[model samples]
Target chain A: MTTLDATLDHPRGGSAAALLRHATALARRSLIKTARTPEALLDVTLQPVIFLLLFTYLFGGAISGGDRAGYLQFLLPGMLAQSLAMGGIALGQNLNADIEKGVFDRFRSLPVARSAPLVGAVAADIVRYLTVCVVMLGFGMLIGFRVQTGFVPALAAVGLSVAFGLCFCWISVWVGMLVRTPGAVQGLMFLLVFPLSFGSNVFVQTSTLPGWLQWFVHVNPITPLVSTIRGLLIGGPVASHLVVTLAWMAGLLLVFVPLALRGYARRA
Target chain B: MTDLVVRAEGLRKRFGKTQALDGVDLTMRRGTVLAVLGPNGAGKTTAVRVLATLLRPDAGSAFVAGIDVLKEPQRVRRRIGLTGQYASVDEDLTGTQNLVLIGQLLDLRTSDARRRAAELLEWFDLAEAAGRMAKTYSGGMRRRLDLAASLVGHPEVIFLDEPTTGLDPAKREDMWGVVRNQVTQGASVLLTTQYLEEADALADEIVVIDKGRVIAHDSPDGLKRRVGGLTLRVRPAEESRVPDVLRILDAVAAPGTSSSPDTAAGARPGAVSVPVTGDTALDIAVPALRRAGIEVTDLALHLPSLDEVFHSLTEGVPAKELV
Candidate 1:
């Protein structure tokens, strides 16, 4: 029986190192799950490409005054931002599913840091957001969308969207921890993201909307993210929109990170 | 150093209207198994959760390996492993992947984690299926994998909440063997179950809880003794002689002893049983039957089983007498 004791010496390293190790391990598990069930990737892959195709062809002529190229240029960045927002929902759904399956109980019983599972789930989702951006960009270029800025600026645009998506994910994490079912996570996230995506400058300029609606569009969190991507990828006014977008990211983290952690801790 | 590895006193938790745990107390020495046996909704799971630091007790204190559960939960976590009623493994990952992930979470080095995972998979008899996704494994295999995952850190105290709840008899035996192996390896165990036989087989001390309160706590033999002394059964050679045999049994029975005929349809045609108080009753019974011209087909002494003890304890029998 001492053989069992010899096999499990206390894990080496400091507490912080242990936390990082646990987080990475959990992230690796998420990635493996995605790899095994490739269908789960449809949200970040097929969904974005389909959105790019259907929107670019169906609404381009009507919205852009018959100039499909101009509409494609405008729509690509908005679609990328939209896809990033959609990507954030997966984190909540995954967490909710894990909770439903009692997987988090195993995580809770471990000696790892309390926040590691939540943090690891968010980290793994960043990869999903990056995948969606690449797929959206590649699909958009296949038709007629061109990046007006240089390659570095276009990469920076995708990077910025990924960062924003990560920040937005805390809302989903919080919702996931608070809800009892995976289906509830999906429903709640849709209620939140649907209007934010449509009411903003994703398909058409906010100016086209009624005055009252324009006020909401201008202040919507997605608006700054869409505008920032538009400036970086297709060249537009950026400084003010960038600041608002950063502020929103910071505000979201400040509010939702603690909420998510607390919800996770409170859940037995 | 204190030999008691787990101690919980007056732990109370209420889930809205249902008091899941009401003033539950548990204690286990190092390298011993303390089995908490109870029916459904009897709060066995709740007590284990509080001790494992998965749930905070509404009142009272618990210490695991000398760490206060509520105040030093992290330290307690480091010294304990828990396998809940449900198989809590990522179904998408392979068995080896599951164990390795837990190992890594416990902060083992990458290579060490991999090695440990392989060793555990082999020990759990999952080496052949180690590369397959957990979703593909059968129920018994999934449970084994879950148990293997908990051992990745070699926890000093393990909480197994109904470890063999849904397992077949053979699989249950396998799980019992694994638990015994853990105890022999010097890890204290606190297990919860509804199976009295499971308690009899695995527990060093059994705590029987019902309706969120401990009804009795004793060793397997000690519990059986509470139901009283050896039972004497006498089967007559002729079915018509049952009355004569019962009369002789009653006459020979000591004062205060209860004697009854086996009237159930399935019972042998002429069978009678009597609770014999002292060892001398058996000696008196056999000679009394023969002297009365009663021929006997069978006569023997029987010890009360845990099943009878469990039934009497949970069936609203007074707890003070049994304790």
Candidate 2:
């Protein structure tokens, strides 16, 4: 018989080192794909610029009772939370599109870890999170939203928001794996993110919300997340909300990471 | 059997009520092309998917390079590469990046991956488009990139699922050359194709499947011989005499099929043909036509093309009946 190539011939799932390598390689692929289609980044880049302007002008006066500067400070941190969540929908939509295009089938046939594609995809989405964070904060600060807590804490605030986003996008990844089409992924993620973004204290203080609506706002993970960002950026008590936000990020990773991996493995 | 690069037994998979694969077994020795020749929806892709470890069967044992495909799929994957029916290359990545990503995923270092990608791009004639996104390439170029990506690992076995299904004739011929080159490099190939001519040109052996079952398995010539060898065709001088020629041809051919002769059904103008067992049909018909005063413009006994072979295979008779 002819000799086979001196290949790895390793067991299923591969070793930890190999898994990390595969995931990183796939992450590189995701980044290159993102860079190739720079226009797809409009959701992360231009959308935040537009939304920050619109909301600051349109609702700033009404919500802050003509204290539009105060409203800008209040709205900026919440905008990070909302923008990052919306940014994740694009990740979900892209995953679904890749699945439909049979790109994942090629990945499946390769000798990589089963979770490599998902892990790589989620890791690459840090680009989106960073983009949304910078775009929102840059535009917000330009329009009179001050980071009262100084640059280090403000950097921490951006870091915290991006971390929360990185955790939250697992939901998008899982839904992307679960759905049949790219459009369906977009629609379903909106249905999930819409409630999470609006039903929380993302746009207003919890007390400002109607009493009945305030219950769900306190429970929504984005609420504590926004509160933590606000506490870091706008000089509020942060220790209690920080713990809850960290707990929520950990909880999301716990639930959706496995679900996303299993869905990726089992689904077409 | 021990030299076989791929072996599968009783590979059965069902998608709802449709049996995508039913008791399909196959084997391919090292350094040869094994064509899974079948019509659309005939379990060809299902069998390829199972063998490539992309889809698991309900009941089966499959091995690639002697590794259990289901239990040690990663080992199997290490030895095998697959290019699916659809363009599997990421449309958003440049051709060079796509191949390099696959090489890196296969554990090549960055420099080595880039080197391998460059070589493959050169080999596939994609060097000029290496920097362009795959979505910008034409269909033929995209298929070439997909095939090149699958080859990044220098796998021992390759699975090409309808690689030429949508390609033009020139492009299909290019694919055939690539398959032959891989075989020359000692890589065994399992090629699923709906084109009989492709199998004949490329495969050492062909397994013809229909309705989720292998109906015939043989070398291409053996398949044609089993379907009664050749067809006898006769063209009369006068178009009006086609019915007489059809009747004469039918009399000379065996009566395996109950297809009544039809003068109006001539696919070619003034020509009549029938599946004959061998060249004796020509010897028998020439003298008979001379005596019957039927002047013929053309009369020849030639091997049945795939259209005719397909006709006899799918004519409601079991393959064994024809054998």
Candidate 3:
């Protein structure tokens, strides 16, 4: 067959094969593009490592009262949550750039599934979120942060972190759609994420704060996520935190995914 | 007939207070290139967008490759390729990667996508630059790559909306060649352009739209015939002898046309223009001036051009009035 014949004559997929193939191909391209530009992972790699070093070494002594090494255990889990949360901004930044550059418009003109780019981008972020978690876990070990929960729960902890990251990605997609410029996305995301990161139970236990602040922190979605990761990493029953975190994930998917789909339908 | 790949009737679209497309109509046969010509803000891009399934029209209907665009945009999208006015390729990927990405999106197997990417790269003469990042490509290269990317899915109908807007003349010619190749291969092409010369040189059929409505549609020569008959121009060798050339022009076009002197002397020394009334009649109000007493440099008569037709049609009237 001629190249055109061979290309076009292929079975257009709605079958089981089609779904698997499209997803795998999209993820592969996303990974290849990311691998080609190692700089794309700088935030994913550096954020977790930086937090692990700064919070554990510098402030652990003052905050946890002389058990700085022991504090490593407490800080690593929170850093994982913060790392993945902050890394989610990459989604907004990249989406803004793609939209501005007309890449999304190009995709819209094609017969490809509209969800491919969105799904691919979020799926590719899976690697980024996982990488940050693994790097933090590795460096935490070097800095005297042991995983009291051992191996299986460590993997579960990373899974929870990545899932939370994916949930945040949906929110970021909405932000990316609303804010079409890359610089604007940077400004808006930083402004929104800074308060969410600091005002929650990320750096300290929420109960230590004032009553009103504690209430807000308790309701913060990241608090349940951080608490869940902490429980997973520290060897205890993480049932309630996991349940609450999963509920948040489900809630975000329920609300923001539809908004994202709407924005995507309009923007694309 | 089955040969008509695209048919639109009373297609209308409005954006807020502005009517972007007003009762636009078009028809294109299979294996032919129809160039849609209009000025900026005249809704050429909007028309293409509607046909490409990217936008929904407020009223009317369109069919592309036998599928109703509004009713089944997915099917229309499957049958047609669209190259928007801007370069719409993935800027972060290499040229080959961009093409392959579309191929994969079209559901090609991995090896098949790569092979198709290579083939398109070779066809567009981008093989050497295929591995380079698209961001580093020049405007012309990016445009060609965009066109190539559009073709990766083997779309039977292609909509090129102002595909050569920003390119230099040489690159524009290259794009014309690409469009020619597509039509020659039996792909129905609806090309939008503001450049009358591009339409004249490339279009098998021309549809001229002003504001949002199509004003004229025909072959280039046929459309040129409607505005005016023709013109005969005479040019004197010296500026001092311009009056002499005007006298000759007056002898020709003056009898029933107009005898305004200011209009007569307004003729440039190198040119005195007069309308061609018929095939062989030289009805000059004044005799050949150079033969009588004036020395002239050059004289000629020719049919009206698409440019003149466009200017006469669109000059003083706003596009909305035409609508």
Give the winner by DockQ: 1 or 3. 1
lDDT string for model 3 (B43-158, tens) is 89889888988877899999988878878676666678889888987666899888887887777776999999999899999999999988899999999999998888778999
For model 1, residues B1-323, the per-residue Cα lDDT tens digits are: 65888888998899989988878888888899999988888899889888888899899999898789999787788789999999998999999999988888877778999999999999999999999999999999999999998889889999999999999999999999999999999898999988777887899998988777887888876765665646778888887888887777786564677578865346655689887765688678878887888888888876554456557665665666433
**Which residue runs of candidate 3 sit more than 4 Å off their true CA positions?**
A1-20, B228-311, B314-323
Residue B235 shift from truth in candidate 1, angstroms: 11
Q: Please write out the lDDT profile of model 2 over residues B1-323, one tens digit for every residue.
A: 35988888998999999988888889888889999988788899999999988888999899888889889887788778899999899888899999989988888888999999999999999999999988899999999999999999999999999999889999999999999999999899999988777897899999988778877789877887777666677778887877777677767776574213324344666677777776677788898888779998877766555566668777888767533
DockQ scores of all models, one per candidate? 0.58, 0.66, 0.53
- Model 1 docking tier (incorrect/acceptable/medium/high): medium
Task: Give, for candidate 1 chain B, the lowest lDDT window spanning 10 residues.
Answer: B314-323
Better of 2 and 3 by TM-score: 2
Better of 2 and 3 by DockQ: 2
Positional deviation of residue A218's Cα in model 1 after best superposition, in angstroms: 1.4
Q: Deviation in angstroms for A83 in model 3?
A: 1.4
- Second chain alone, TM-score for each candidate: 0.79, 0.81, 0.80
The candidate, 1 or 2, that scores higher on TM-score is 2
lDDT of each: 0.86, 0.86, 0.79
- TM-scores for every predicted model: 0.88, 0.89, 0.86
Q: Candidate 1 has which clashing residue pairs, if any? A: none
Give lDDT tens digits, candidate 1, residues A142-218.
88778898899888888898899999999999999999888899999999999999999998988789999999898
